[model samples]
Target: MRIHLDTGRSGEKLAAEWLSQRGYTILACNWKYGRKEIDIIASLDNILHFIEVKTRRGHGFGMPEEQVTRKKLKNIKTAAEAYLETFPQWRRVQFDIVSIIYAPGGHNIQLLEDIS
Candidate 1:
């Protein structure tokens, strides 16, 4: 469990850095609303993004993004609504997933946007 958590944290860090390099301004990390959590919240080109970060060592289970089920997306949406209630400046909102495959030598990352 600890290893799994560590890998998730590492992946989220990488995802944040990757998004920053691509002109996203990170607003929050691990932001929670009620019982739900948003792994990362960022803005780019005037659009607010709620991102879910999923990481895995390999494809033993499946691709990282494949783990984001409809229920997970619904949770993210619920959290995002709470976020907007606090800060309603964003007119355009998007849901995304940052999928990471953490290997020994290299890591594969992919961004799936507008998931919701």
Candidate 2:
């Protein structure tokens, strides 16, 4: 099934809002490098966080977090390195994942943080 981009963007927005409420300050959204994209770059205190957001309409395929394979992690790491170069002041760097499972028949959003 092909996922619609508008729906995906809405999910990302919801995930960002949830993170912001948890004290995370968002630095970038949809930051890309070549073919890879980092959904959210955020900071909490002094730690710079490279975050990936995955969304699913249902659990038929798998949990959203399960989609982040090792290869995908590698891409995120590479893209993050490029991202950090822009902010040399940040010494602490970390990676995180936020899974958003939208309600099967509605707009409800559920979030899981730091899965990676």
lDDT of 1 by residue, 34-106 (tens): 8899999999999999999999998898899989999999999999999999998889999999999978899
Q: Per-residue lDDT of 1-116 in model 2, one digit per residue for the tens?
A: 34667657877898899889989999999999889899999999899888887777777778878888999999998998888787788898888877777775664454544545
Which candidate number maximizes lDDT? 1
**RMSD vs true structure, all candidates:** 0.7, 2.3
TM-score of each: 0.97, 0.85
Q: After superposition, how far is residue 81 of candidate 2 from its true place, in Å?
A: 0.6
Model 2, stretches more than 4 Å misplaced?
104-116
